[model samples]
Structure formats: structure tokens, C-alpha cells
Target: MKQVFKRPESLIDVPAHFCPGCHHGIIHRLVAEQIDQFGLRDKTIGVASVGCSVFMYDYFDVDVLESPHGRAAAVATGVKRSRPDNFVFTYQGDGDLAAIGTAEIIHCANRGENVTVIFVNNTVFGMTGGQMAPTTMPGQVTTTTPFGREVATAGYPIKMTEILVHPTIS
Candidate 1:
């Protein structure tokens, strides 16, 4: 018999610290699978920003950088610019990428940075309790908005990809 469910070599052989029912571990597995499939284990550098996945450095075997809150894009940009030969990627949450680091990601995309970004949008801020995030869906309830989100007063949940792909004129 052959083993078909071996863990990816790019990922550490340890249990993840993510909360139960959370998709962070799933996302990590996907990233590790890609790294292993592309034989980039030796060339990949991951940037971990503040949020639920901040302990990613302990999960991946490759070099990992811990960026300030919502600054993963900027840190990854520097890493990629300095080492253009390496494959740099950033793992960030909706709160980090869409709310706090909005400008960083937009500018990085605009400048065509040679880096990959894995943005996880869970709607609420996972690390800091279940608070409303920039990607929260319409009428979604959170710690910050116990009565469900009020679009009239709170404005709309931002669609980051839309803004990145096509910026609207103010």
C-alpha cells in the first residue's frame, strides 16, 4: 500500500494553534501544498502579519517575517525587492489587508510587486474577538455591531478586490 495523505514537506509536523472550525489551518495547508508542489520550499519566504495567523512562523519550514499590524504587504515588498530571486508571499486577514493596510496592498498591486498575497476574509476580526471587520457582510452581526450592521450609518462593507482591480473616481 502507498501513503497518499502525507503532510507537505514545506509545513512543520506539528498541530496548528488555530481555533476549532477556523479555516486558517486549511489555508495554511493550501499554501504549503503549493510550496511543496512548486519545489519552492527552499526559495519561499512568507510574511505573517498581525491577526489570527500571526504564529505562522512556527508552522512553515521556510523563513517567515513577522510584520506589524496590517503591514505585511509593505514588509513583503521590501523582502521581495531585496531578494528578487526568492518567492515572497504575504498571509493577511481582511482586517489587516482591507482595513489597516489598505494603502499598502493597493500600492503594492499598483507597482506590480513580484510577490504573492494570500488574503483571508473571514468577515470578523478573529484575533481580537469577533468584531466587525471591513469585509463583514451586509446585516452581519458582530461584537462591535450587536444589532447587525447598519449600512445607513456604518457605510458598506468594502470590496477590496474590486477597488484593487478598478478604482472608482471620487
Candidate 2:
């Protein structure tokens, strides 16, 4: 029998826990596919952040570490520094990365850490009752912002990649 579909070796066989309409599973598959393509399954170490994808350790076949809420970048930094030969990455959502772990992520990028960050910007805090996250678009509504987000008061959504690449950061 010819198998047309097979799960990436870097991903586990267990069912995912991500909710419907959520992109966590798709993002996870992409990450796993990259790891498989690079033949990094054995040498890759993943840092699982808080929020919806906290159970990432159960999905990825590689070694996975759990970081404190919003501390995945810091934890991945230490892991990469301790074992420079390994490929380290962090799986973080908008709520965890853009809101709680902003400082940690900025510092990690500024220092040019040898790590990859798989940031999933779903706009809302999916794990925490769909609250308004830092990545929530302007005029978008969430549980916390019942009347839609007010940029005058809430400020614009943060563009993390731009902040990371800003010249002022270096």
C-alpha cells in the first residue's frame, strides 16, 4: 500500500489539543516539517511557553522544556548557550510573547541568540477566555474589549518582528 500521507517524524502521534479555528496545529506542523527537513530532530530543543500551546512538550518528538509564563525566550537562551550545538526554538503565542514575555524576547533578539522563535499571533488570548491580547488588531473585539479596541486608549497592536529588527534595538 502506497502511503500518500505520513506525519512528520519530528511530531508525535498524539491528537492535538488546540481549539477549532485556532492555528496552533497548523503552526506546529510547519515547525515539525522544518525540523524534519533540516534533520534536526535529535539536536533540536524546543521551549514550550505558556498559554494555549503549553502542552507542546507532548506533541514534539524532540526534547521539550517548559518555561515560566512568558519566559520561553529567556529559557531558550539559556538552553542554547549551555548547548551551542543544539538547535533551540521557542513556541509562543501572542498573549505570552507579545504581552507577558515582551522584555525577554526583545532582550534575546537584541543579544543575537542562536535560536528560532515560532511566534503564533492569533490576536486573542485563546487559552484564557479569548481576552484581548497585545497583537489584537485595532477595532477588533475580544472578551476584555467588549466594545472593540480603542486605539486612542489601547494603543496600536505591537509589531514584534519590526521591533526586533529595529536599529535602535541594537
The per-model lDDT (C-alpha) reads 0.89, 0.90
What is candidate 1's CA lDDT for residue 138? 79
* Sliding window of 10 residues with minimal summed lDDT for model 1: 161-170
Backbone clashes for every candidate come to 0, 0
**What are the models' TM-scores?**
0.95, 0.96
Candidate 1 lDDT, tens digit per residue, 15-49?
A: 87787899988888899999999999999999999
Candidate 1: give the clashing pairs: none
TM-score, model 1 to reference = 0.95
Off by over 4 Å in 1: 167-170
Please give, for residues 46-125, the per-residue lDDT of candidate 2 as tens digits: 99998887878888999999995799999999999999999999999889998999999999988888999988898999
